[model samples]
Target: MAEHNTSEERADDMQTQQAIAVEGLTKIYGTGESRVAALAGVSFAIDAGEWVAIVGPSGSGKSTLLNLLGLLDRPTAGRYALAGRDVAGLRGAELARTRGELIGFVFQSFNLLPRETARTNVELPLVYAGVPGAERRRRALEALDRVGLADRAGHRPPQLSGGQQQRVAIARALVGRPTMLLADEPTGNLDSATGADILDLFAELNAGGVTLVVVTHDSTVAARAGRVIEIRDGRSYERDTVRATPAQVAAPRQLQGVLS
Candidate 1:
């Protein structure tokens, strides 16, 4: 992958390194009179290494879109491709493997196993991916180091501070080195100061060429991303890109590629 690209170069070549592409994406629940169109023919594309936020009020289909993007649910009628592969038809072991290897997710709630050490929690994805124990340990430690949490690897979630717990969650996400990172309200539980630091980490990761797609209602959170997509009534609308940190700019808090 290109280490850096001018905005023009990036835009011009987005199609070549597409991370996600959806066309006429729709999701329906129930049937007949009870049927609801949770997502209505929404369509969009996100390029590799780009950071995009999905924002909308509650019940506006933001969650629906996020679920589809994260591969937690399938669209009822549409084409969805992730990491340059068509994922709309994958099922059983194939679908499970693709989801495990192609995406890393961070939820608003730090979902670490309270009884497990940070290292073990970070190793979970690798386990599901069928990695060898020794390799998983190496990668898990490497991932914790990336998130600045290597020192806390022996601590369980309950023993860490809230911010530390979140860091551990981030480490877990990075352990797989997936094609994209999907965050849902990643900073929702932290104070503004701590949240900013987390955002900075995300910026560094993006600078290091990780693609990020965040779901948040906070404008400040959305502003941190290079682009934003708003969902309403099951439809999607793209907003012009804005920034807390420019998508391709060197990370302000750290040297570029620090997380690579």
Candidate 2:
């Protein structure tokens, strides 16, 4: 009986693990008449290396879920775990450390420091993580090179074009080598061509085993993900998974030369 119980416990523990997992997650604001439920109850699990997209119209609670997933805000109820560790109630330095260590962020605005060079901006996360100066610079440059922005290392945000600035932001996000990458409307500010290039880059990264969670209203962006989750009225519903054609299956290798 004792051995059987131990085996059952192990099996249950194994089932809860993933890159991201949430059960009955809810976030509420205000009280009574003014109360609003940003997320009523969302439960989902994203496996490691899976590319998932969250899509919804405005005010659908997608943004609220993103904030919760990124650990910028706590849920009012239920559970959230990243890499199988519960994080629904993390706060203060613990929260900051977990977020910094496990997640990378890319934004639509290309949030870079106007006065700082590309390499400097890319090194910011490592600095906050207490990496030494010499190692930080090397890692930052490597990340920029991965995104095809190595030659622009000395350029400031204002000095670069929009696509270039966004690349720099991607490099910055990659510098820390976080367990997951969270992007919010990453292509919102770019032209169609440029945005397509970025999307291809994201696909390549996902192919290379990076876990991605993107929140967007753009159908094109949502289509790029392997799985889509729709948020409506603070609830979540899983859409059909995107099946890849033969050519699409072979496309990741070809994506390497896209930015080049």
Candidate 3:
């Protein structure tokens, strides 16, 4: 009994520090005859520094869950606690501020500004957050360095290769040192080799204690994460049955070998 009570106490403490928590989360579109439920009573918690992957086929609630987690959309009926603060009801400027302060986003499309230098692109978030110019520049350069794009910081998006541009996007996402990194199909556009490299970068970031939540349809990508949450028909389930191919499991080992 004592051990069970201790375990329960530990779980409560862990939840208190959770980077993202959702309970009974639901999103519905339209109404009556045209109603569509994107997410139906989803519940989960992602702890700080853990690597999680959300995987599903087309029409699943993967994107819908990502939107809610990123604070881009509100749930119809649920509780969402980001970094221990309930934010399910926050809207407008409050929502934007919370998102900017606690969450960093990386999209499959390298959404870099076409005419801006990589450094300038990375500085945009800091600019919005009201960081001073000199400080923003310093942080942007540091973020670029973290993603191994410091040498290309002066180059515009069109001048960089696809992989390089994605790295710049990642740098931009990390510039503010957000509490959680939310990536949606991050490697969807890259070639196999380049995607592998990006996955390695993600592993490195996770190793350094970044809380990462990746939304992808690729089983290989999901295999690399520490935990996999499979969403189907607007509901989430923790995947315990192995869905990874032998090659998929071996890929991360190969990456680890290279890193070593």
Cα displacement (angstroms), candidate 1, residue 140, comes to 2.3
Residue lDDT tens for model 1, 1-260: 55587876754465457788776789999999999999888767788899999987788787678778888888898767776567767889988888788788886687889999999999999999889999999999998887678798899999998878887888888888887899877887777887887898889889989899998878899999999987777877776533332223221221111112
Would you give me the overall lDDT of model 1? 0.80
Q: Which residue ranges in model 1 land beyond 4 Å of their true spot?
A: 1-14, 31-34, 158-162, 240-260
* lDDT head-to-head 2 vs 3, winner: 3
Q: Model 3: residues >4 Å from true position, as ranges?
A: 1-12, 32-34, 241-260
Candidate 2, residues 3-54, lDDT tens digits: the string is 6568656555444336787777899999999999999888777777899999
How are the candidates ranked when ordered by TM-score, highest leading?
Answer: 3, 2, 1
- Model 3: weakest 10-residue lDDT segment is 245-254
Give the number of the best model, judged by TM-score.
Answer: 3
Candidate 3 structure, TM-score to reference = 0.81
Better of 1 and 3 by lDDT: 3
Instruction: Give the Å shift of residue 210 in candidate 1.
Output: 1.2
Please, what is the TM-score per model? 0.79, 0.79, 0.81
